[model samples]
Target: MAEPSITIRDNGPYVVTMPVEILDAKGNPLTITRERITLCRCGASNNKPFCDGTHNKINFESQVSA
Candidate 1:
């Protein structure tokens, strides 16, 4: 396994790399299959944490630096 990395996108979700485990409020885990995943940051996703591309409509802004 590779060292996990998190990438903050420009006005978008936080891109996360696997193999990783994300826990819910009940201490359950989210089932992830993709090697890379996008998590919501704008707090607009119908599916919280995971992005549903709502930022584009709400005009959220944030720049990510390497």
Candidate 2:
């Protein structure tokens, strides 16, 4: 059986609700999921990739102007 994969939607807030196994660079399991998670993409988060509601402070927008 293959390991379960999580889908990350582009230009949107990445949310993870299900239990998942976090891994290290060497394919080793780092930690098991205990709660929900939200990741940031704007690079303005003080949490550095983790949602800390800081995106709102810097007016971080994910949509690109075409």
TM-score (all chains, Cα) for each model: 0.86, 0.53
C-alpha lDDT of candidate 2 relative to the true structure? 0.60
Instruction: Please report how far candidate 1 places residue 28 from its true position, in Å.
Output: 0.7
Candidate 2 residue lDDT tens string, 3-57? 4444454454566665666566788964545466666766777764466877677
Residue 33's lDDT within candidate 2 is: 51
lDDT of 1 by residue, 1-66 (tens): 667888899989998998879999999999988898899999999988899899988999999786
- Runs in model 1 deviating more than 4 A are 64-66
Candidate 1 yields a Cα-based lDDT of 0.90
Best by lDDT: 1
Pick out the ten consecutive residues of candidate 2 with the lowest summed lDDT: 1-10
Best by TM-score: 1
